[model samples]
Target: MKKQMKILDAQDKELMTVRKIEREGNALIIRGKIFGAMPMVAKLTPAEARAAFSLLDMKTILFLLSFLFRR
Candidate 1:
C-alpha cells in the first residue's frame, strides 16, 4: 500500500513536489520531488515506518472516541 502527500509553498504553488511513501514486498519506499523537478526516492525499514503509524492510529482512535463521547 502507498500513502501520498504534497508540499506547497506560501503562494500555494505545487512546488513540483509529492511524497509517495509506500510499502512494497518488505521495503518502504519514500519519494519526493522539488520545484516540479529533482525527483528522489529512498527505502526505509518497515519497522521504523510502521512504528510511527501505530502511534498515529492510536492517537486518532482516541481522539475519535473522545469526540464521539463528548457531551
Candidate 2:
C-alpha cells in the first residue's frame, strides 16, 4: 500500500504529497512538499500521527478548513 498522499492549497490546487513516512521508535518522520513547490519534513509523535491521519486526505482537510474560515 502507498502511504503517499497528496496535499492541496487553500485555492484547491495540488500542492504536494506525503512522500515518505519513516518510523524511528516512537517517532514518525514525515516528508512532503509545500505549496506543491518545495520540500518539507517533520517529526511527529505517535499521537500526532494519529491526529494527522484522522482526516485521511488533503481534499477533506482543506474542505474542513475552508468551512471553518467561512464562519
Number of the top TM-score candidate = 2
lDDT (Cα, tens digit) per residue for candidate 2, span 1-71 = 86678877799788777889888789988899876668999889979868878857888877877885685
Candidate 1, residue 67: lDDT: 87
Q: Which portions of model 1 miss their true places by more than 4 Å?
A: 1-5, 9-16, 19-24, 54-71
> Residue 70 CA error for candidate 2 (Å)?
26
lDDT of each structure?
0.75, 0.81
Best model per lDDT: 2
Q: Model 1 compared with the native: what TM-score?
A: 0.41
lDDT of 1 by residue, 1-71 (tens): 44556678899987645567778889977788777688988777878768867777676868977886788
Query: Residue 13 lDDT in model 2?
Result: 85
